[model samples]
Target chain A: MSLDKATVAHVAKLARIRVEESDLEPMAAELNNIMTWIEQLNEVDTDGVQPMTSVVESVLRQRSDDITDGGYADKVTQNAPASEASYFVVPKVVE
Target chain B: MNDFASRIIQGATGDWEMVIGLEVHAQVISNAKLFSGAATAFGAEPNSQVSLVDAAMPGMLPVINEKCVEQAVRTGLGLKARINTFSVFDRKNYFYPDLPQGYQISQYLQPVVGEGIITIDLPDGESREIGITRLHLEQDAGKSLHDQDPNSTYIDLNRSGVALMEIVSEPDMRSPEEAGAYLRKLRTILRYLGTCDGNMEEGSMRADVNVSVRRPGEEFGTRCEIKNVNSIRFVQQAIVYEAQRQVDILEEGGSIDQETRLFDANTGVTRSMRSKEEAHDYRYFPDPDLLPLTFTQEWVDSLMDTLPELPDAKKQRFIDDLGLPAYDAGVLVAEKETADFYEQVAEGRDAKIAANWVMGEFFSALNASSGDITQPPVSAGNLGGLIDLITDGTISGRIAKQVFEAMVESGKDAGTIVEEKGLKQVSDTGAIEAQVDEILAANGDKVEEYRGGKDKLFGFFVGQVMKATQGKANPKVVNEILRKKLDG
Candidate 1:
């Protein structure tokens, strides 16, 4: 239920978040408090309960295999910060 | 065991064995994306196929596609795998530029298909069964073109949110050849099911190979994953290089660092991509947007009924019902179209002869002209007619070859070719006896040697008789007359 500074830093790195080193202890403490509050539910004996994926009592809905939305490239990339020739451009990433 | 014995690598200290497993990602053949209504066609204008849900815009929800689910179920049945009526989708968290959603919805705890087995036919006429671990559905990320720009990468979201089946195999394969056979058989099955195209070159299907080396009969070694091998040849090559690389490390007393690697086709080598320190920690959780997928056993059975006769069953029937040799059966049933053609040719004819013609001259002609079996130059019915000529004593097997060549050249039926060319077999005993007497008169000294116990000379007399008759004499009648004339 506790979050250490290193764990917080690792989580931040995984999320690609720029967390200041100076705020690590405070953030870890705050996250620890939240986790401790959430851990209180572990005390309840709910072995037979099923895990819930949705709040609504409905099965997953399926769509037919039809192309109903496309062909508007301009609208598709309208929100891109940088685009060229109908492509979203970002920093080069090679693995 | 003998075939696999050659696959073992001899290190400086001992013989090393390779343990291989494959993870194949096959794109579902569907018109639209997995969770969106956008088109899934390839080679479209960049971003033209992207929908709001695929782009992972805020508040956009995902809806499953019925066709993709049905395809996954059908594929499971084809593999003879167990279908889980209840399965859930989980979000695999990661950070990547191409993955705009920052998480890929995959099946983790409960996969759609459970364990199964696939029997792969080897080149040495032996087969081994490879185990299937699981098959689950996931979303494909958008393609990123890194070489497009100097300092930036161009991203096309057209492939985003496409449905892909991640088929994982057990670490049962001990050789690169086994790995190759396994991929080919799996591709054949996938194509038969019509679930996935299994076109590796077009990027519709690709495999991730895991290779490790260990001393024979020891615990499994640390393995490395080679990512996105696009072809079966490259997959085999990657396993060989990676297995040797691991062997060299172990022989030198250095342990392998379990991580992901990349196979370079040009170099035919695998290089480390990421180390264990930066390994992925995919925290998976059930997605709240979509509920668990549930279906009845009756629905699964209905899908099963829709599956075509897979390669294994067809191969077995060819051997059991048609009395074909295992090798011929394997070759005929490798492709669905070829198998269908064989069946058509073998319909009321000699199965073995039909197989020989289909696998021999028929296949050669098709290959020489680069023709597909689906649209062959010679139809199956015409080939059957050609076989009929030899079966009913219309023409000798030797003359039948000439007639077959003529049929191929002129697109004429076997009967027309036989009639026009006068290539009918002379099965009359009188005509064969006259040719045999002429040969006996000409090769008088050889005939004496044949009566003096040089029995091999009898073949020469038969050859001479066949030559005199222009290869039109029925071989059985020629043999009978030659035996009587020479022996008397």
Candidate 2:
């Protein structure tokens, strides 16, 4: 449940967050406290209970397999930080 | 087990056994995306097929597509797998430009379909059963276009959230041929079920090939996955090259680094894409937006009942019941449309004759042109009629072949062609006798020589009679009358 400074730094890097070196110790301490408290909730002996990940208790309703919604590229790309030729543009990723 | 392990590449260290499995991603045949109402048709404009939920807009929820789930179940039944009554969907968290959602909705721990078996028809007329580990339902990612611009990468979300059935197989293959046969057989079954079109070139169907090498009876070596091999040929090449690479490494006292690799089709070699440490650690959890899928056994049974005869059963029937060669039966049942056409032609007729004509002249004619069985120029009824012309006394076998060529050219029925061309077999004894008299009168020397015990000259007289009748004379009657005329 506890996180060291290096582990906190790794978590920040994986989440794409820029955690400054000066703030790493405090961030690690805060994360450790939260993780400890969450671990307490796992100690309860609720062996027979089903795991519920969502508040909704019903199966998903299916929409009919039709092509009714489309051709709204302008509206879809309107909120993008940058767009070119009716497409969202992001930094190039090479693999 | 008469296994066709023909292509086992021998290494200096030992005879390395090739272990191969496939994870085939078949795009479901539903009209809409798996979780969104977006159109799932291929070849649409780049983003014109995207929905709000498909584009991963915040606060948007996903509604499962019922048709997709049904397709997955049907495919599972075709694979002879267990259709679990209750299964859950999960989120596989990853980041890529093509993926609009940072996490893809996939099944991890609980797939919709469990272990299935696919029967593979090997090269040596033997068959093997490959184990299917599981078949799960998932959403596809969008396509990223790198070549569209030199300075930037373009994203198309058309394929995002599209329904896909990820079928995973156990590592049961020992050679490249087995793996190739496995894909072909699986594709045939999927095409038969109408769940996937099984077109690898169109990206609708693709495979991730897993390859490992080992000594006989030894624990399995490390396996590296070659991702997105689009064709069966490439899959075989990848397995061969990857197995050899691992064997060389081990033979040289080098350990294999577990990794993900990519097959270079042009070079016929596999190169490491990424090592194991760099692999994406997909954090999988039950999808919060959807509920666990549940259905009764009745639903699965109903699907099974409606299922068409798969390739193996249909092929077996063609062999045992129809008495066809293993090769012809296989070629006929490779595609559903071809099998249906064969059935229509063979119905109530001599199936062996039907099989011969269908596989011989009919297949070659179709192959000569680039036409599919769906739109064959010669209909099944016409083909059956052609066979009937030979079966009955309407036309000789040679004359039927001539009529068949004419049918292909004109797209006319066999009977119509026979009547129009006046090519009916002259089975009338009087007509053949008259022709025989004329040929004897002209070939007086040959007739005399034939009576003088030159038995070969009798064949010359029959040839002349056929020439005079334009090859329409009944062969049996010609033989009988010519013998009587010559012997008398």
Candidate 3:
């Protein structure tokens, strides 16, 4: 699928990314390049080659399905940048 | 050559067949995040569980957690998917504030597990086989705080680098209901496998719904992906709206566009987000720093050995072994924990009785108390005691409920509570007969009227007998005695 410059900008805005105006040309070019690379796969003889999905070929390993404590609160909280009363706090916004 | 495909083809028109697919991302239940050893707990303070690796700090390189790989393989086996003897991780380049990493570590050209099939049960006893595409392991991105700030945005990396198994389903579902059922059956299987917790509300598991509309027998229409729908209700809603949207476009002489869309829960519509990109858009190549993941066949065999009775087998067991109705069995075994609890309670007792109490009184009490089967106030053994009392006719159904309430309040066994509180039914024929005689003598006018074809007065006599027994008399026994006395 081809994405025009205007469409790319709109997508960037929706994704909440700040894309420089000068970079839009390069971004569009790179996107076109990527599409060309995907098109190359069409040349391969995949008539019988199954599309690869997962890495392993086996049955799923399972537990007893009993609910247990996930176990690790303190260690999880240790990486917080800002914390108070076991909560990670952000800057106050509302007056 | 089967009649199924022919029927579907004939029902529609032309050579167009509906192709359906699914991509399910299940959050791995682990103590720590996938790449980092930081805790992977839910409902924690925002951004508290993030580690340096999760924060995408400059000197950090991801070391793949071995358990996450095992889990991915385990899930592959569950789906009966082909596990790649060797799989490589790739960097999927994407820029978002929530993704501290410039790119997400995901499986692109080579995933951990490959082609498999998942058989989804339709509404009736009929089942349909949906092709499995792949199951890959990836790291989750952080959360964006949109509601918290009007002008500025904040990132919570608590979920970042958390282990996720992306189980993709083939485009095999034809209808929205089938899609929903596929999701539900997938969730049940994952829950049964213990590979993922399947909690959509907590964002532990989510679906990226791929939908398209085509004529009955035509080639596939341009597909659109509705991303990150967390709940099953939203999944259904998103598909319905997206499918209709595609149909509308096609009907208007405009071809369907292949793109990614966002499902707005508030608006109940899917808005186009961006044109979908192929794999090369991310410049995916094997991660140079990490080695290709390989596992021994022995390990895979052992993991397979540990597999529990999955949902399908368990449902059949409930029907054949426990003699439960298919609907009841399906409900109980939908989640592994509830099914296990039911088994514990029904071990030596009557299965039907146990199912009734568990589905009725037990579930209601748990809901009323806002507790789950995990932390039920009444234990299985105690509930079995209550069932036994009712079964032995030691307590009538009405009195059994009373005793059950006491069991919940006092945390006492049914026998002990019944003994101490004198809640047992007066089933003794002699005792009930004496009470019947007293009621007949006291209500002589009513008794005369009852025998004089005033049959409705029989209820009054039964009520007096029950009152004499302090509401603990066996109701059936009382009715029989009162009827015999009135007829005489």
The per-prediction i-RMS, to one decimal, reads 1.4, 2.0, 9.1
| Docking outcome class, model 2 | medium
In the range B1-488, model 3's lDDT, one tens digit per residue, is 11222222222223334455779999987777777777777867765677677777678767666677777888888888898877778888766656777788888888989999877776675778889999999999887665655554566677888889998988888876677778888888888888788889988889999987677766778888888898888887777777766656665578876788899999889997754443225667676546667778888899889888888889999999889998889888878889999999998899998999999989999988956778887999899889989888899888888888998899999999989988889988899999999888888888778778988887888888888898899999999888787895
- Kindly give the stretch of ten consecutive residues in candidate 3 chain B with the minimal lDDT sum: B1-10
lDDT: which is higher, 1 or 3? 1
Q: List TM-score per model, in order.
A: 0.95, 0.92, 0.77
Off by over 4 Å in 1: B1-7, B275-279
What is the DockQ of the complex in model 3? Answer: 0.08
Question: Which 10-residue window of candidate 2 chain B scores lowest in summed lDDT?
Answer: B1-10
Q: 2 or 3: which has the higher DockQ?
A: 2
Could you tell me the lDDT of residue B283 within candidate 1? 79
Residue B362 miss distance in model 2 (angstroms): 1.1
Error of 2 at B402 (Å): 1.6
lDDT of 2 by residue, B1-488 (tens): 22235446578866877788889999999888998878888888778888888889999998888889899999999988999988999988766777877789999988999999999998789888999999999999988878777788888888999999999999998888898899999999999999999999999999999988888778988998899999988888788788888989989999988788888889988987763333266768898778888888999899889899888899999999999889989989999999999999999899989988888888889988766888886899999989988898899988988998999999999999999999999999999999998888998887778788788777788888898999999999999998888896
> Tens-digit lDDT track for model 3 on A1-95?
78778877876864558999998888988998898889898888888786553566643232232222223334544655754444334554221
Please provide the root mean square deviation of candidate 1 (C-alpha atoms, Å). Answer: 2.3
By lDDT, highest first, what's the ranking?
A: 1, 2, 3
What would you estimate as the lDDT of candidate 2?
Answer: 0.87
Q: Give the clashing residue pairs of candidate 2, or none.
A: none
